[model samples]
Target: MDRLIYLDNAATTRTAPEVVEAMLPYFSESYGNPSSVYSFAAKNKDAVTGTRETIAKILGADTSEIYFTAGGTESDNWALKAAAEAYASKGKHIITTKIEHHAILHTGAYLEKRGYEVTYLDVDENGVVSPAAVEAAIRPDTILISVMFANNEIGTIEPIREIGQIARAHGVLFHTDAVQAFGQIPIRVDDCCIDMLSASGHKLNGPKGIGFLYIRKGVKIRSFIHGGAQERKRRAGTENVPGIIGLGAAAQRAARSMEERTAKERELRDHLIGRVLAEIPYSRLNGHPTDRLPNNANFSFRFIEGESLLIMLDMKGICASSGSACTSGSLDPSHVLLAIGLPHEIAHGSLRLTLGEETTREDIDYVVDALKEIVARLRDMSPLYEDFVKKNRQ
Candidate 1:
């Protein structure tokens, strides 16, 4: 069997050994409900508190402001819904971009159904939102502005710092879905003037089913989950002690080696992009060339279906994605691609290969060679390619 070259780090990551080691203690010998008042339980509760503090320190937020949740989707949903409800009296208007994750897009749709108005700003050809566009969309009734720190599909990093400043100057709250950007990039919520931020554990080589939302002090957000008094009555349910501990461990590890890891990933990612474009015909790279995530490399191969390409890559032991893992089953082209002005046919052929800390130059070489061969074979069988070639010959 060929060695598996896993390149789909944006979807999720393999849990680090350190994270697993940190979590094991809570799952067995220290298996106690974090909300319990008993001594054994109190120890677990302390661990949860410590984890919150660790996460807060990483994000430059206050310990009391961090609220743990199931994952990024939940955190995003909570931020949009809770803020809309809490500020309904002040205004029912929200602002975001067209390239956001479905977590933010779908949540915005839900708010619209409940009488809230949402303005979705457009992105440029490189899948980048303009800060001026955000400011122009702001209405007097706008209560909150939500934008993703980085796009999961195209890997385009938005102008979040400028957007954050716009929101602050307008006196509207700002929230960012930082699930994809949190571990890959350095984020200081205070420096960016971000009022709220959301992140997930699995995206950062930590255990799944654990994430956190950072709410700046005095931000009016209503209860997300209704039940016990966990998360200081903001979020409900007993805490996942093991998951939290693992997330903290993962966060610490990521912060310590972020600079070195990012530099290496960027080098490999750029090399892959350059090779694929130079080797393949009619291939176009997606997203901003220099401003995108260090680990993400997305491209569209003309005349082939993305699903077919993904299947071929999988058979070659090169795991890649057509787009977001959440939207893989859909027959329609990626919304992110369409928003960036790609035609339907071009959008349908997009492929994403996200790198990780463990990805090596050898793996990149193997995948690049595999992709070139696959694209050539796929194009040979494609009637669209034949027609395109014939038309160009004229």
Candidate 2:
């Protein structure tokens, strides 16, 4: 059997061994509920508290400000919905970018249906939002602004600090979905003036089904979940003790090795992109060259569908994605791709390959070779390619 070359780190990461080790004991002997009064439970509660403190320190946020949630989606939904409800009297208007994760875009749409007005900001060709545009979009009724710290599909890092400053100038609440950027990049919420931030554990090599929301102290946000005293009543239900512990361990590892990991990943990612463009004809890189995630490399091959390319790569034991996996079953191109001015056909041909801690130069080379072959075969079969060639020959 061929070994799988997993490159879809932006979609989700394989849990780290250290993180898995940290979570094991909680699932067995230390399974006591954190809310219980017994000694067994007290130990679990303390662990949870310690994890929270660790996460808080990493983000440079107050310990009291972080609230655990199921994942990035939940955090996004809660932040947008809670902010709208909590500050309804101030305004019912929100601002966000068109290239945001579906978690934020869909939640904003849902709020729109519920009488809130939402302004979808456009991104430049490089998939970057203009802070000036955000400032101009602000209205007296605007109560919140949510933008992702880094684009998941194209991997373009936004000017979050500038946008946060614009939001603050307008006295509007600012929320950023940092699910892809949190552990991968150096993020200090205080330094960035980010009032709210959301992150998922699985994206950072931790267990799935656990994430956190950083709500700056004094930010008005209502409860999204009800019934339990968990998460200081901001989020309900019993704690995901094991997953949280894994997230903490992952965060700690990320904090310590961020610089080293980032440098290595960037080197490999750039090499992959350069090799693919040099080897494959009619292929172009997506997203900003320098302002992209260190681990992300997205590209578009003219004339071939992304899904077809993905399937071909998968058959070659190369694991990659056509943008968001959640939207995979749909035949439509990703919203992120389309928003960046790609035509429907070009957008449909995009591929995202995200590296991680385990990714090696050898793995990248293998995937690049596989991609060059697969794209050539797919393009040869494409009628559009034939037409393009015929026209160019004239």
Candidate 3:
């Protein structure tokens, strides 16, 4: 690993040095419980408040609306489950996209077993869900609509504002899992008409194990975690003072440099996509061509498996993924690719390369060169590729 290149920012990012520096003091010197009444711990409470304010301002939300959680998983779970419980009297019907992360999908399943009806809407070939379809699926009993702001696997940005408008017009609460979209793009809760949103800290160069759920005022959601009065009595347990500080520091840094950072990432991403598509035969890009995260470029090289591609890339000091980091280990192809109408063989060969602020044109070029060789080697060993070549020659 003499020349290491990390292109898996969507999976997680290296915490910024500034974020670490801000959190260090909270971990040691001023780490008293925020819940404590003593003046010594007052700073901890103030720190949490300040972090909440910083995060809320970024999303155009009120400070009281942001509730800290363990991470995106917890925030997503809390949003769906607690909303289901609180709104049960209104209706037990919920609507969501099929391409959502497992946090939403698995929680939807949990709700289904508890006697709720969930409609998993399909997306287009570009992985964009139609707002018309969402409106069409709306029922008198529909209580909530959960959609991801941007897809975690393919990096496709959904038509969230349109969907949010539909939800609002239907008098249904809308919750977006903004885990991948928060730091990468601009979002305004009020402008989008989003009633609730979930975001994680680690995705944006913040420390892991910290996230927040934004519940619009008067959304009427109940508590998910049962215990003390933390998170304004919505989520329970002790506050993570260090995590809060880190999340704030990361958020501020991301805001100040988002435009410049994403511009560079987008350029690098397109360069990677362009070179790979031109240099490699039978390689297809996944997700929307333009309406995607600036840092994301996913592709499927026919006649090669994703795991083998990842292994070869690792050998070349490159890091990437086949799909969502949470589900990359599964044998089945990505549901996102399948949803976008990719066949099993092609979907099985998908590769996801998510760029970061540190990624450069040199890095992208190196990855493309490695991929060209890797795909050629892998296909050379494939009997299916041989059969196709023979048939074409005939």
What clash count goes with each model? 0, 0, 0
Go through the candidates in order and give each one's C-alpha lDDT. Answer: 0.94, 0.92, 0.94
lDDT of 3 by residue, 244-276 (tens): 999999999999999999999888888888998
lDDT of 1 by residue, 349-384 (tens): 999999999999999999989899999999999998
Instruction: State which candidate, 2 or 3, has the greater lDDT.
Output: 3
| Residue 238, candidate 2: C-alpha displacement in angstroms | 0.8
Q: Which candidate model has the greater lDDT, 1 or 3?
A: 3
Q: Rank the candidates by TM-score, best first.
A: 3, 1, 2
> Per-residue error at 8 for model 2, in Å?
0.6
Report model 2's TM-score to 2 decimal places: 0.98
Where in model 1 is the C-alpha error above 4 Å? none
Q: Per-residue CA lDDT of candidate 2, range 299-354, in tens? A: 99899998888888889888899998778799998888888898998998999999
The runs of at least 3 residues in candidate 2 whose Cα sits more than 4 Å from the true structure, single-residue gaps closed, are none
Q: Give the least accurate 10-residue stretch of model 1, judged by summed lDDT.
A: 1-10
TM for candidate 1 is 0.99
